[model samples]
Target: MALIGIARLASESELLEAKSRVTYFEIAARRILNRTKPNMPFQWTINPYRGCEFGCKYCYARYTHEYMELDVQDFEDKIYAKPAAADRVRLELRRIDRKDHIAIGTATDPYQPAERRFGRTRSILEAFARERGRHLGITTKSDLIVRDLELLREIARANVLSINITITTLDEKLARLMEPRAPRPALRLKAVRQLAQAGLVVGVFPNPIMPLLTDSERALDRLARRARDAGAQYFGAGPLFLMPCAQKVLLPWLEDNFPALALDYRKLFEHSAYLGSGAKRILRARVEKIRDRYGLNSGPLEYRPELWLGEEQASFELRD
Candidate 1:
């Protein structure tokens, strides 16, 4: 049996050596439940897999490993495919009285590279189709989502289904280093376009917008315009956070890549890894204003609207 931990990285060049290979396994979960109203949007959720493969350097989901008593495991290379996720979700839905809605890939990307090898996402969607929930949302940085378009259309016809494609930068050089294993930004942008054309409520999540990096006013304006033109119905953005474990791993990567700015990151993150409430307010206000300026706002924006449902949350490094 495989131990519970992240697979070790070989070398910088070795890490970039691409092969379609992936590993998968079963993770017996404790429970599956619906979202009990009182939030920003939906109520039902599902996670077909744990850990991700997109390998984005600044991913905030790294803290998810804490539940398993693991840390700084890259959140991507560490694999955990819940083979029985669909069956478990189905069994639990029967016990609830109300029509439940959910957010998938909230803790892990359901459409990661592992899904392609394991076909777990397919099984989960089919399960959803059988006795579809009321509302469902999926967030990811993969173009793999395009593969399930037909399945999504069948369920989205009646229920609430939304796809949020997370895109932080359109710059290829930035994306290559940021999300080494993930598809290029253009591909995901194309996926958003294709998904929206199918009449699904597609949105662009310019999330974890780093402090000095892609958080620039110009970066936001450019991406918002592209998303809008490509058919994104809404836009959501937030500041990048330097959660504890993530800081340890990501700060070094920053130092290696942008040596001059490493010191700035130390100072910006000095106040707090997470943005202070005042900082959040000011930044949100500015992002909203920019979204409005670019016609990218779909509705009112809310930040950290509520605590995640007993899920592990991670933060990313920020530059001053």
Candidate 2:
């Protein structure tokens, strides 16, 4: 097939390795830092890899692969690693304002399974560690992040760093079904505890809280309580939003797993990617109540690192 732009680059990428059904390719980085749209909490975003290996059924990021003209179903099967990630990030940081928040792993999990091999995420962090006064945030569903604890501590010393670990459910069976290749919930919580213990501003997010599946008060409360017990500084959650790419995967999985909810999911996400305002309000109330019960902040704790070189502390608003 004729390919253009990113697709062409992807097609020509050097084959790195393949395991099971997933293939890893090494692609050169053109740009590592991206500007977020206006009104977003963060000013910039960085995704070290083109595809996530976790293959979460409800992942909205599956559409990202479409930009390369690849089928959404191949989102997990083909992983693209940027070999020049560290150097690119270092170069891009020079153009960014120190006060603006930079979020890593907004579209792809920086610490995805492929990171163990490519270390692209670690490379980015290494670059961040050399800079001072920048507000940085990282979100991931993998416990492998703990492997870079020392590097994270170095970054935290000079930069305002917040880490968010996403743990959808404590139920191993359900998590296996939802996020087949991601780290187990307990492992993710352990990472949270370690990061918190290391004095990093860390939080737990039960993101994409599946309606009629994992959004019940009981389920959310359990997650919040466990997060608190693990020493997490904050807790947050958002209901699932299914774009077309996600619907193609999640809806069918729902039918095969929770047959009763499949039809409702199709109807709920038919028009928009977001849940209705009423549903969102209810979900917010539920998560807020759970946070209150667990004595957890709603987001990252207000913190200023001692080595902060910014004119003033950077305020990062919790989004989603």
State each model's CA lDDT, in order.
Answer: 0.69, 0.82
lDDT per residue as tens, model 1, 82-163: 5445786678767754445567776678888877777777777776676644666788889999899999998787666778
List candidate 1 segments past 4 Å from native.
1-23, 32-44, 97-100, 298-306, 312-320
Quick one: RMSD of model 2? 7.0
lDDT of 2 by residue, 148-240 (tens): 999999999999999999999999999999999999999999999999999888999888788988999998899998999888889867678
Candidate 2 to truth, TM: 0.91
**Weakest 10 consecutive residues of candidate 2 by summed lDDT:** 304-313
Q: How well does candidate 2 score on lDDT at residue 59?
A: 85
- What TM-score does model 1 achieve against the real structure? 0.82
Clashes of 2: 0
Best by TM-score: 2
313: Cα error in model 1, Å = 11
Where does model 2 exceed 4 Å of error? 301-320
RMSD of each: 7.2, 7.0
